[model samples]
Target: MLGTIIITIFILGPVGVLSQSAENNSISERIIGGHSAAEGQFPYQVSIRVNGKHECGGSIISSFWILTAAHCVARYPLGVLLVVVGTNHVKLGTPYGVAQVFVHEQYESQTKINDIGLIKLAGRINFNAKIKPIQLSTSLQPPGTSCVLSGWGFTNVQTQTIPDSLQYIGMRIVSVERCRAAISAAGLNMPVVDTQVCAFNAPGRGACNADSGGPLVCNGVQYGIVSWGNPCATGVPDVFTSVAANRKWIAIKSGV
Candidate 1:
């Protein structure tokens, strides 16, 4: 049951307003209530930059491929995007030019379904203790399962600026029914489909703007891609694109 909900998408990579559906909601960026990550702690984490700015978070699924939200790269062209890896600090990573982008064919900006996307780097990444690829999840984690989300997104939504150092927080997966109910209670008329997963822990702690396209790792496997949610972790469950649900599509597109 889809209803009209105000979706504040944290679209950090793109520089302009995204007109999704009739609402035409504004897009911003961040991660709320998180802490600084240690060096090499999240080796698969990466910063998706546009025009030399850190705009979105991504994961290194392969030496030549990165996985992120379709919204992060869907609206922009190839030349403007760059991927940086191998560092916890956003400014001190190895940069790679994008060669190709593969957004899900059925991605819908309004509904935020099938929000996965892939990036093929112009050159291969050199793996080290500080840089590596993450394994894709083959199954959906049950509700209440603990997971870690890492990114260089904004620590505060009001500031609307990304942090130089990577940030991470522990969150727990919630049932789709609970997610839908929470969104409805929050006055958002958006549907939480099976292709999407929801995670939440407390009211003030959750994914915010600029946290989009980041990885949700459970048991060391990447299971979700940060998609959309209430602004700055206002306790409303944060939604993500289920990597397990889109594994085949990812393999077909990137062969990773």
Candidate 2:
């Protein structure tokens, strides 16, 4: 009945990472209403740096590959992007140069469709207690299932600065039908395709600026990629790239 809703509501725009903080307070102002993660809590979490600063978050899917939103790296050259793993704090890890960057061939920058991308590390990442690859899910998770989203993004949209350590929050998946209804009620005219998943955003709980390209994990599996949503965790559902929908694309690009 609502098949057409997917064509009419919510095609997300480029979602930025948590903004860089002032010279001071760079590491303590992370995700909105979230808490700090312990070391190895999310071993696959990665910070995607550009020109030596944390610009976005990503997930390690294999020793030599990372999965992130294409919009995060589409504009930057390969030389400027560095993938850092094995650390919970943003600036504490060694930066590995990217050997190659692959944006999905069908990525639509205008609407954020097929927003996934991959990075081939210049050198293989060594796995340790604090660094490892996350498994990718091949099935769709039902709505209302709890998932964990971790990133180093802004805690407040108005402020637009990030925390020192990685932050995480538990969120629930919103049904596609309900998500479309909410966007329609909000008067936002965009598309929500099969490749996208929507996560519920309660007050003070949601991905904000600078949280893009991070991993959205469920049952310890990489199920979603942080894509876009209402600024500042407003009471609207945040959208992600459904990993299960694009698993083949990831496998081909990552060779994992």
Candidate 3:
């Protein structure tokens, strides 16, 4: 039916991450609305600093495990990576501990598919007010629902990374059919794989590299994992790893 929508809507850029917050109220609103999370909800979400160098974000699904995109993992080797939890401050603070990291055996860069990996921490994460795990929904998220995403990534495109304070924005879920049509319209085939989901109405919101593997909390539940977004925050819809689709694999690995 609407298989050609994806091609036509290649990409229109999105606005900056509300860079207009100069007043105390606007700044406070940004803090509360964007990056603020209730204590211990998404505890597994942490800033992954490699060799104490670059900071790539990740999510902890288990006491000893973290899930993140393969692209982020491949940027460096395992031993050089260190996991830092409870990081709201960007440049200062201790980021937990890193024991070992394991990449998905099937991840391939050229395909930009199967982009998932896990990190095994040296020690069980200390459960605390700022450290909590988000619940992964085992079912596909209902379309048209409001979606919440957060990250330390930049507010602008030219920037390559996110700031210290985690920032976030709320968006709506795009229907599967609409998402497929969008891709098809772009001269790409409709995405029918169980691994992906498309969210809707992100006029000025999306992932900018630092948000990989973080939760897409919808309706008070974790629905999706950030995967990819080109020209992020624009017309190109952000793609995610459908939590429902990988339940079996996660269950096998995480026993959840």
Candidate 4:
């Protein structure tokens, strides 16, 4: 029997609550092997916050809809989660309350498949230089296609501290054959399915803790949602919710 594999769904860190206590300085920053991004470089990027701190990353699909990983908000109530958009800096973004949260009905925590989610903003976000909506990719990119990932995740996995500014990293999509081989080589027999998009983080490049729910954009079209991956950027292929395969779900949830 293929033994059970405890796939770690990166929730960024311990579940953050909607509290007013002093900020915890130990949460691992979300992105690894990325540089600082300009204020409006990724206009569709949004920070999913809890109690005024960046908890996970999300993408603005429309004025009122944001797409993210289901595991990011599956446990929280609809109204407690907040969406911060219109800025790159985490603390400087415009905060909007979430009116509803739609986690994919088929989401599986054990395998981390169907890990997509959507958030409806209480009010429409005003489009500006620092805020806009991105188009979801309807087709899959070939292996080795370059894509951009943006987030305020941890700068280094060992240190577990997030940066003061937003971060961006360029990554290449990994072939399913190679991805499965890599996982097997790591002593894991986990299957990499069509619904999951695998991308290379190299040895020092990729999304880390708290980056879940962020977008993987290829050629300016949102391609994937940061789902789960091996700890930090350890050259392991990171798994994402394949946006191309879930286009219908996104369209139904966001009407985009």
Which prediction has the highest TM-score against the true structure?
1
Q: lDDT at 55 for candidate 3?
A: 46
**By how many angstroms RMSD does model 2 differ from the true structure?**
7.9
How far residue 221's Cα lies from its native spot in candidate 4, in Å, is 0.4
Ten residues in sequence with the least summed lDDT for candidate 2: 1-10
RMSD of each: 6.3, 7.9, 8.6, 8.3
Alpha-carbon local distance difference test for all models = 0.77, 0.72, 0.54, 0.73
lDDT of 4 by residue, 102-184 (tens): 99999987667798999999999999888989988889999989888888877766566777788988878877777766655
Question: Against the true structure, candidate 2 has what lDDT?
Answer: 0.72
lDDT tens per residue, model 2, 113-186: 89889999999889989998999989999998888888888765555567888888887888777776655444
lDDT of 4: 0.73
Q: Cα lDDT for residue 248, model 3? A: 71
Which is better, 3 or 4, measured by TM-score?
4
For model 1, the local distance difference test gives: 0.77
TM-score, cand. 3 vs. native: 0.77
Return the top candidate by lDDT. 1
Error of 2 at 96 (Å): 0.3
Off by over 4 Å in 2: 1-30
